[model samples]
Structure formats: structure tokens, C-alpha cells
Target: MRWTVHGERTILDTPWVRLRSLDVEQPDGARVAYDVVRLRDLAVATAVDDQQRVLMMWRHRFVTDTWAWELPMGLVEDGESPEAAGARELEEETGYRPEVMRELIYAEPAAGITDSRHFVFRAEGARRVGEPSERNESDRLEWIPLADLPGMIARREIVSSATLVGVMALLLDLRA
Candidate 1:
């Protein structure tokens, strides 16, 4: 069964977020106003090296007030493709440019309330061209061994939805 969306009214509209109330009709014949959050799509890069390690950054998320490891990522700009945005963000945030990138996963983490999509790509390899241009993106950059991912995740160090999905998929792939 699928819910029918009669219409939607915006409660707030901004560059970063859009909030709306949707008039929906349930399959069982109940009508309700459902609140939703719309956010800019994100592009994420999971860059791995020859040694089975992935490039990551330690950063503080002001919203959650927590520091954790994450893949280089950013919002996809209006005129750029997700791949291009991922490559640009990788260099800007980590000073690494991927030689080649391929789509890894797509996730709508909070689909229950938010329509934000995360596009994750795997970088075949990357080279450091210079220091990170985005000064406040992260506190430090490191190449973490993939073998340690389970422990890190267990410790709650890798917490971002996109990062978790991408790395978990990678881990799952290794089993096949």
C-alpha cells in the first residue's frame, strides 16, 4: 500500500534546508499533515589506497557536537554533477584528487522525514596535490586501514550515514 500525497505547503525555504507540510491520505482512508525536511544532496568520496586503507578525516559536527571520522564530502552544487562535486570536495577537504572515481552507493538515510540523498563514490586512487584548501573542513587527515573499520564503528568513531553505508558496502563486498 502507498500513501497518496494530495499537496504540500512549504513552511520554510532556505539555501540549506526546506521544510514542508504534506497533505497525505493513508491507504486506510485517513488524512494527515506530514512534515518533511528537504536538504541539498551530498557527494562523498571514499578514496582507497594500495594498502587497503581509506582516506578519512576527523571532524566535529556542530549539530551533534561530536568528533568522528568521515569520508571527504560536500553538498552538490547547482550546476555540478555528483561525481564532479565529489572530486572537488575530495581535493578541497583533503588535498587529494582521485585519479578515477566510480559510483559506490546511493542512500536516503532519513527517508522517513527527510528527502536528502547521499551519493558515494569509490576513488580508484588519489594523489596529494597540495594542502587542503578548506581550512575548517576537518581537524586532521589520515588513511585508516579498512580492517579496523568494524572496531571503529563499534566504538562509534565512524558515524556519518554516508560513510557508514559506503564502508559497510565495501566490507560486504570483500566477503564475496
Candidate 2:
């Protein structure tokens, strides 16, 4: 059984997000309203080097009040393709350029109440160009060994949803 959305009303709209109140009807003939958050799609880059290391950013999320390692990512701006945004964010945040990039995974972090999508790209043969264009994006940037990821996740040090998904997908592909 599927829920039918009869209509929607905008509760809040802004450049960053849109909150909608949906008028929906269930298969059981029950009608109700649901609120959903809509956000611009995010592009995430997982860059791996020749030495089996991944370029990552050590950053603090104010909302979560936690510091963790994360893949370089950002919202896809208007008219920007997710691949282009992934490559752009990789360089902007980590000062590394992807010699090759391909889509690795696509995910939605919170499906129950949000329409946010994440496009994760696998980048190989990354080279450092210079300092990051956006220094404020992270406290420190480092190349962490891919083998160390399982321990980091177990320690709760790599906690970003997109980062976790992207890294695990790449790891699984590597293992296979």
C-alpha cells in the first residue's frame, strides 16, 4: 500500500531549505498531514591515494557537537552537476584534485522526514595542488589509512552519514 500526497503547502521556504506540510491519504483511507524537509542535493568525494589512504577533513559539526573525520562534501549549487560539485568540493576543502572521478553511491540520509539526497563519488590518483581554498571548512586535513577506518568508525570518530556510507561502499568495492 502506498500513501498518496493530495497536495502540499509550504510552511517555510528559503535558499537552503524548504519545509512542506503534505496533505496525504493512506491506503487505509486515513488522511493526515506530514511535514518534510527539503534540501539541495549534496555531493561527496572520497579520494583515495596510491598508498591506500583516503583524503579526509577533521571537522566539528556544531549541530551534533562532535568532531569527526569526514569526506569532502557540499551542497550542489543551482545549475551545478553533482559530479562537478564533488570535484569542486574536494579541491576547495582538501586542496586535492581528482585525476579520475566516478559515481560510487547515491543515498538519502533521512527518508522519514527529509528529501535530502547525497551523491558520493569515488576519486582516485588525487594530487595536492596547494592549501585549501576554504580553510574554515575543517580544523585539520589528513590522509588516513583506509585500513584504519573500521577502528575509527568503532571509536565514533568518523560519524558523518554520507562519509560513512561513501567509505563503506568504496571499501566493499575494494574487497570484492
Candidate 3:
């Protein structure tokens, strides 16, 4: 099933996000209008050390007004590759640099009303080189054991969708 776009109009355009109004023909031959959110694609990195621990950050998101464990992530800047963005975010968020980085998975966190792609990466051989860059993004960073993820998620400790998907992808890769 496919929908044909009749026309589209931009309602709001900002540097960080854009909202568009789409007029389309639905798959059932119905005409509809949808408010679509256009956001920059982001990349999240699951950095694992020699002991198989996953690096996580405890950050408070103002929009959600909640603190949760999240993997190092950031928006994919214009003209930058996902891999590069992942590496840059890993360093910027945790002050750790990975020697090896590989794509683990790609997902759309919300597909119905938004167009944002998240690229997850597996980074190995990471080492802390200096203090964190003092960015206003995170409060604390820690390396947690992979096996403890399920309990953390259950307790609402790890709520970031990209982080969850990234860890699950790594787990699936190992099981395969």
C-alpha cells in the first residue's frame, strides 16, 4: 500500500527541527493531512571495554524532565558521516575515544509522524583520555555491565530508545 502526496506545506521551520503539513491520498483512496516532524538524524554509540561493559551516561532531558541512562549520542551534523558522528559523540559525551568503531544497527525511533534515523555503532577498545568536555548535556558517566541491562530497563533506569536498540543489537550480534 502506498500513499500519493497531493501537496505539502511547511508550517514551521527551525534550525533544530521542522514541521510540515502533508496533503496526501491514503492507501484506501482517502485524502488526509498529516503533520510531519522533520528532525536531524542522530547516531548513538555503544562503547564496550575489554571487560564487555557498556558505557552509559546519566543525563537529564529537560523536555522529558527525567534522568535516565543513555548511550553516547548526538545529531549527525551536516556533511558528516554517521560513523564520524558516532565517534565524535562518544568522545564528547564520555571523554572516551574508541579505537574501533563499526555500524551495529539503524532504526527509526518514531516512523508514523517523524522522520529521524538513528545509527547505532559498536565501539571497542575505548579509553578515557581526559576530563569530559564540560558540555551541558550530561551529569554523570559510568561503565555498566552488559548483563545488568535488563534489570536497569525494567527499573526505568535505561529509557533511551536508541540506547536500548543499540544494546539489543549488540546482544543479537553476539548470539548470532
Best candidate, TM-score: 2
- Which regions of candidate 3 are displaced past 4 Å? none
Across 13-116, the per-residue lDDT of candidate 2 in tens digits comes to 99998999999998999999999999999999999887888888989888878899999999999999999999999999988998888999999999989999
Residue-level lDDT of model 1, residues 91-117, one tens digit each, is 999999999988888899999999999
lDDT over C-alpha atoms for residue 36 of model 2? 96
- Prediction 1 global C-alpha lDDT: 0.93
What does the lDDT read for residue 142 in candidate 2?
A: 89
Task: Give TM per candidate.
Answer: 0.96, 0.97, 0.95
Model 1 residue runs over 4 Å out of place are none
Worst 10 residues of 2 by lDDT: 123-132
Candidate-wise lDDT, in order: 0.93, 0.92, 0.89
Worst 10 residues of 3 by lDDT: 130-139
Q: Residues 99-131, candidate 3, lDDT per residue (tens digit)?
A: 988999999989988999999999878888877
Candidate 1 vs 3: which has more lDDT = 1
